[model samples]
Target chain A: MSDIDVAMARALLLARRGPSSDPNPRVGCVVLDDAGEVVGEGWHEGAGSPHAEVAALARAGTAAHGGTAVVTLEPCGHTGRTGPCTAALITAGVARVVFARPDANPDAAGGAQRLRAAGIHVSQIEDLGLRTEADALVARWQQAQDLGRPVVTWKFASTLDGRGAAADGTSQWITGAPARQDVHDLRADADTILVGTGTAWTDDPRLTVRDRRGADRPQQPRRAVMGLRGLRPGSVLERTGATVLDTRCPHEALRRLWALGSRHVWLEGGATLAAVFWQARLVDHVVAYVAPAFLGLGAPAVADLGIGSIDAIARLRLDDVTRLGDDLRLMLTPTPDPTEGA
Target chain B: MSDIDVAMARALLLARRGPSSDPNPRVGCVVLDDAGEVVGEGWHEGAGSPHAEVAALARAGTAAHGGTAVVTLEPCGHTGRTGPCTAALITAGVARVVFARPDANPDAAGGAQRLRAAGIHVSQIEDLGLRTEADALVARWQQAQDLGRPVVTWKFASTLDGRGAAADGTSQWITGAPARQDVHDLRADADTILVGTGTAWTDDPRLTVRDRRGADRPQQPRRAVMGLRGLRPGSVLERTGATVLDTRCPHEALRRLWALGSRHVWLEGGATLAAVFWQARLVDHVVAYVAPAFLGLGAPAVADLGIGSIDAIARLRLDDVTRLGDDLRLMLTPTPDPTEGA
Candidate 1:
């Protein structure tokens, strides 16, 4: 592989070490000396921290002069929480720069143009036939920017026959321990965990991410309950501070979540809430935990979404399948409607 | 590997070429000369055909003197269609023999004892530290012998939400093309395909195995309709010569099928019929084709089976998982209850 390919791969690895739930993109930078010897490396910790380029330049010090910097994303030219990365690179006397992805945020654009005007050579990582590996690291943030709303991932656990609860509505444990732990990981990565008032009142879920040993994680997603129904006094959700969005409309609840700066929302809603989101075509992703058991009678996992025939059935493309203990975790995405865009 | 291991592997391969739906076990045999060279090979075609040992001995002719016979099953000592295989082996001057599985049928066993009584050296294939590879070839037959009835495999196709049909009862296609073709192959391997009058009248299914190109296979399984309700006159099942069991009890239906010599029964019954069998614990195996689509409102793939609480839910052990185009084929078996047997 070429030097650019090796450096880009290392940069991508470093980018993933950053906090996932942060609104800012994860970026990593590597500064190579003129002779291509080792120098310095740094990754953005989170928002309000120094950018990757500035951190790497500080670590390089005098060695950064006439050195080349390879980064996972374009160096920002506009100042936000910190100063412009392009100005830091110029002051560090970097001779050449390579970046994997262009800045898609309007406020962060024009970084490459600024660097070139400063008499430094700048080239795209694609020029060397190296694809960006950091796209998934910032996919949710970028999608939120594109849609102007939090990217919704609807998650549910049910038996293999799709029963969410028994006849008496006792749904405490549908899946095994490992599948439940996997959902905790998903919750830890999201900025918000959402449920409906029915779920909050009936199930009284704590709506918090917990470790394998049942201890609460240091970083917890904001919990939100949607629907107009009033929650019971001293419910688990009320006991543990949760935002209550008083709205029956899925779009309105999502808009409220977006206003709260929630980039990715883990929707742990009940059947009715899920059906509404599905009918509104607002669910961006689906995570299903299927237990290897059969409950021949129970509440269905999903309610009616207005589909009355086979032709109108909602189809999804299976993206990933993982065996979690005695259960199966399937990740899927909705197949785009061909007639809608036209 | 030893000489016996090599010969036994080849014998197992030959055994699989026999018809799967036959009542008789598939057996293969290989004759080896004193110099350890294979002189003859043969496999049982089906019932009413020459046994594998006789066929191989016929081909070996004069070369069988003082030779070894490696077989997938013990040579039958008591015969119905032909003479005992032990007599033929002893008459042919076979000096030694090695067999994989001992004959389990009471009426046809004792081949090893008979051979030893005739002063011929007989040993088991396990003595060579090799596993019997032909067990699956005759598993259905052996299971039927043990249970005193046909082994039941309930097959169903449904959407991801466990819906077998839309709200209006339109259930033409739930799974993709590949999964449907797989069901046909299963039907070809079974001795009988069974349904209830509900399915017979509503769906009007032909209940015939067909190839991928929609041509009917030559060896079609016997079709049976089991329910108290009589099928409509000139319905597809009645016109196609399906047997009417006229029973609502799962046990009685199975007893009737056993008397008809149906060793493996593939049940393609509707939801209500499936629930009754499930409640009676008559389902031995399950084959579920899960399509990657969702019908939020519809008839559940399974109806109430008296399961009211999570503790009463029926649990199954996942045996195998296979992807069939846009669907998944899951093979599962019921977990035996510990309390009932004791």
Candidate 2:
């Protein structure tokens, strides 16, 4: 097999890893013989498991000796879940290593450096397509590592006129069933569903993942209630099992959630809470669902972010625009302002 | 010629009409001989001009006899600025009449019916593609004829948070230059720009079409001020050409504008005025420009539209969504409520 064949094999092995990898990057490895024939293949299943290279080396046995290791991500040089993959490759007597994307995690980065120092031929795959594909698989984990907290995704559904509810506070349904199902799909990707105490207590929502037919999902995200306000004993969130954090500060709540192993936080808080996170520049992503209907007067999707003038207004980089039923779903990320000294 | 060939020829002839053909539907015509050879072609130049079919017939002369007349729109039976196109085709001894779109204007729609009654072979082109193209060319005029009033397109530019102005009314430029330039292009298509007394007296905007370089357009729309408030001395609109209407009712103002030969009206009024037109269902279309900025506290793009509940909220059919600079422009048309007995 050629280099292209090895890269294709690595990509296939990477995709074999299911959507269960969290906190750690999803990586795949393939051991190739001297003639570039794939001998063994393995992928990182989840956290607290053997790294891809180590798993592949164990399967390859003596066949891994003098073999080239083709991987989606750079093998880790540090010990976290299992031993460092670099040491494992070296112990297995691998002759060469070819990886797609460079590991951005500071702790796990120096794998190529270690391999080269050990006289193993190490090459970073320069294919832009393969690198982009590998990077996207670990984008959320990389974001969490860079921010030192769970990546926050604020999801909101509102009327086309920007109203979250009617004048009389009737907001039982703003988006259609399709958009609601999309929200559930979004929640499935997150490990934690966060809401302010005001929402948890006032709306008393059961923040549980459910399908369009109202059937509970097999994998459910933990419900988290932030802010100083306390939840009532018989509240829906309290009864449905929620972690109550008595802090109004967004950073503190995010720190606690990160400590609880949450890599992605889905924020379903009210407008005021969203504004607080937005003003603090803690929101990583924004997902807005705009219904075709117009309620001229009602609660706004975002309120009072301390923006007084045009220059102070926040800007977001639009990523995707999709239509679901009669509603539009906009995916955006906050554009970092250079003036803010980020 | 084949129907496809004639349809394509008619489309090209329609495209020959200049952009200044306002207050009237642009139309094109072609005459084909018995041997499928093109005899003559013509397009409506502007308002007060001879209809396309008449001009084509005059050019064809005796060649039009026993030939087929192919037109973008069903030839008119009622005369406006010139003689009826139906009478011209009959006098020219045309054997068959084939048109792309049926004339929606009640006053001019009886041409096909009369041609059929005269024992002439008449057929409406059933090609959906050609009909759609022809209908789009005269969409606003057809809408005006259907509603018995000038087509109202409410265009408003706002911050991404749906604010028209800051709390202190400092909204000089919410969107960037590109979006503002796009708005001027939109204004150039309308014959009149309507605003309420509040907007006229407060903002005092010079409602004129200008290019990005601030050069005035050759054709400027009439700035119309509705409502009873008197304009201050030396107001911008008063100094620039403007028409003052005492009635605040959107329907009455539209009717008066229609009688003045205005076919399309761009409403640049304030939120209250916009709500009035929206609630009355007088707004035929909406052009919203959402800037990627946030003004936490400010005037909303629209205010209290007499809707208290979610079910009563107005629904608009979205037509186009485009990004102009950092602004998102949404083009929507008001969907008539069946309950209102359209």
Candidate 3:
């Protein structure tokens, strides 16, 4: 394979590290000898383990001399649980290094500079395809690091007209089965799932990640409920494992989750709770699964957001749109532009 | 080109006939001689014109003998303003015929059967690409013929959150200039543009078809207002020439327009008027231009449709989703399932 093909493969390997690699970016490495044959491959499997470059170098051993390393992310220069990858590569006598994405973390950045200082050839591949894949895999962690809070993704299921439930509150299945399955996949990517106390009492949902076969996923997001109201005893959420916080503030809940080393938080609350997050300007992303039906009455997907006029309304930037069965899923993010203040 | 390629070319020619061919399907034909060289090409330019096959046969003249005809639609077997195209093709001694789509109109079908019985080589291309193109070009007129009423396309511009205006009713430019330009394109395709009397009094809009250059288009849909209330004498829609119906009934207004040979109606009324048509089951199509901005406290795109509960909500089938500048344009149609009751 060419350098880009090998980098993309390394990106796939990095992604295999899964959501367990929170608070740290997933990294993958492949060592190639003089003949461009892959001699060893390794990924940063979990926290407090050997760095991907160090693991790859150990496997390559003598083959690492006068060889090139292709990595999904730029090698880290900072020493954490393991030694810095840059020092290990130089110690292994690596000749060249090619990476798909630059490590955005300030402490881990300077690997290219250190390698070049040691007279090693270091190249950053501007391949958009592989770089995009690697960037998306690390976006939540990067956002958490940049914003100093857990990146919150607010998810809701609504009718095509934006109604979340009927006047009588009968919203058993707004979207079909395929869209619900997609939500489970989304849950698997987050480290925490949160709902309001009203939802915990009304729906009594056990927010565990489950696959299509109804089996528990290997990694499940920690279930959390936020609100002053206490949960009913022996409720599904209370019976099944959920962290009940006695606070109504969205930021406080996020801070607590961040303290617990959560990088991503999926919020699946009702309209009133969504408005609270919107008012607090804590919602980073919005995922709305719009079913192909209309409820002229019932409830709006989001309650009045303290927006009495049009100019005060919060605007969301559209990221992606997909059709899942008869439903349309729209992924949006809070606009980065500060002029449109939340 | 192969037969399918030649048929696709004919479909493009048919589309070139444009929206002027309302009340009749646009069609194009190309005749190829035994040597496989194109002999003639023609398209149905207007409703009263000779059918595509007859026009092509006229152009081919004696060159049509022992030639194959490629048509966007099957040759018409029934007579209308002109003689049957199938009889003309057989009289012209065309040896073989290939068509992209079969004639679905009840009065116009049986052309393939007649050709086969007359010892002519008839082939249906079954090319979904070209057939879909031709079918969409005539869907409104075909639906009108089937339902015996003008096909109503209810169009409304809203914010991304589905608000039609601000709290103070300032809705001058909810969508960007590009989405408004697209609305004019939609208007140019319809035979009538209808609004409520309240909208006529409040907005005073000149519902004329205009191009991007701000010049009036060659053809304009007739402006119509449906409500019991009278329009202000000096209003734009009143002074600019609009038909003010005396009745508040949606069905009565549609009957009047259909009697005037209108095949498609573009409804751009306010919330109340839309609810009337929706509840009456008169709205067949919906075109929602969703702006990227939000207006939480303005007007909802649709009002109550007597849907007291979620189960009674009207469901729509998604047809198209498009981006116009920073806005989203969604084209949808009412679900055809009988259980939906609309």
Highest-scoring model, lDDT: 1
Q: By TM-score, highest first, what's the ranking?
A: 1, 2, 3
lDDT of 3 by residue, A15-43 (tens): 56745437667778888887777787777
Candidate 2 CAPRI classification by DockQ: medium
Clashing pairs in 3: none
Q: List residue ranges in candidate 2 displaced over 4 A.
A: A1-21, A30-42, A56-69, A79-83, A93-96, A116-121, A211-213, A338-342, B1-24, B30-47, B53-70, B79-83, B86-98, B104-128, B336-342
**DockQ order of candidates, best first?**
1, 2, 3
| Better lDDT candidate (1, 2) | 1
Q: Report the lDDT tens digits of candidate 1 across residue range A1-342.
A: 678778888888888777665667789899988888658888888767888888888888989899899998988877443236899888999999999888878888888888898899998886434443666667888888898888899998888888999887777688999999999988887888989999898888898999999999877889999988967789988877799999989889988888776888899879899888888889999999988788888998878878888877788998888889988888999887533565
Candidate 1 DockQ category?
A: medium
Q: Residue B175 in model 3: shift from native, Å?
A: 2.1
- Tell me the tens digit of each residue's lDDT in model 2 across A256-311: 98888788899997989888898888999999888766788988877898867665
Cα lDDT, model 1, residue A317: 94
For residues B214-290, what per-residue lDDT tens digits would candidate 2 score against the true structure? 99887788889989885767998887658887897888888889887788899997889889898887888899887
In order, the first chain's TM-score in every candidate is 0.88, 0.86, 0.88
Interface RMSD of each candidate, angstroms, one decimal:
0.9, 1.5, 2.0
